[model samples]
Target: MSLQALWNQFLADPGRILNDLALFFTLAGAWLLLATRRREQRATARLVPQNEAQAVALDESTARMNRFFYRFGYGCLMLALLVSWYSTRL
Candidate 1:
């Protein structure tokens, strides 16, 4: 197809375009985060030699937050995929 025709086709379904963009960006961000995540950095900042209990709590909290972010990122990616696929098929 010609460039102008492709552009027109894309413009015909803004929802499809939006879904594609969301899918790309969401997965990209998730990949970047997973690639560079640093739990030790966060945990070290909260850990204190004088307070063992506080240190344990801080570690647990940090781990929980990390797990949450990972899950959220994966969820966004899956949602994006579903949206894109549904939009394209219709």
Candidate 2:
């Protein structure tokens, strides 16, 4: 189909598009959270800290990453919820 046709279709019913956006964000957030958790677990399992300082540094780094990823993933989920709610009001 042509771009014009797609645009017209979208204009006719934007709720469908918003629903799709919500689904995409929901999946993306869940996948990001799960993938990063698995990756971090595997990485930490394979690494061995030689000293107390090294262990502390590793722990700090992991905690920092966990915070960032969790925040971003939750943000995506919140965005998806907002989009879904907005679509329902349409």
Candidate 3:
């Protein structure tokens, strides 16, 4: 289908959009968390690097990753809540 057709389809069913958003975020958040965990494991398994810069970068990466996934997870959940609220109003 064309892009416009797809957009029109989604608009026709507002609840479906919210549900799809919730599902997408749930999956994306879980994957981000898992990937971060794996990266942490691999980081520890590696021998200490001669450069101090690498350690600093790793710490920064972990913090950023955690924040992003946490926000993403919560935001999507909020969207699901919004959907429910909207349904009641309808």
Summed backbone clashes in each candidate are 0, 0, 0
Best first by TM-score, ranked: 2, 3, 1
Comparing 1 with 2 on lDDT, the higher-scoring candidate is 2
- Cα shift from native, residue 54, model 1 (Å): 17
Worst 10 residues of 3 by lDDT: 47-56
- Over 18-43, each residue of candidate 1 has an lDDT whose tens digit, in order, gives 67777785777578467536654555
lDDT for 18 in candidate 1 is 67
Q: Which number leads on TM-score?
A: 2
Give the per-residue lDDT of model 3 (tens digit) for 1-90.
999998997889867765676667666656766776777668765635556556534577676876786677566656656765665564
Candidate 3 or 2, higher TM-score: 2
- Number of clashes found in candidate 2: 0
Q: Which sections of candidate 3 miss by over 4 Å?
A: 47-90
The per-prediction CA RMSD against the true structure, in angstroms, equals 6.0, 3.2, 5.2
Candidate 2 ranges with C-alpha deviation above 4 Å:
47-57
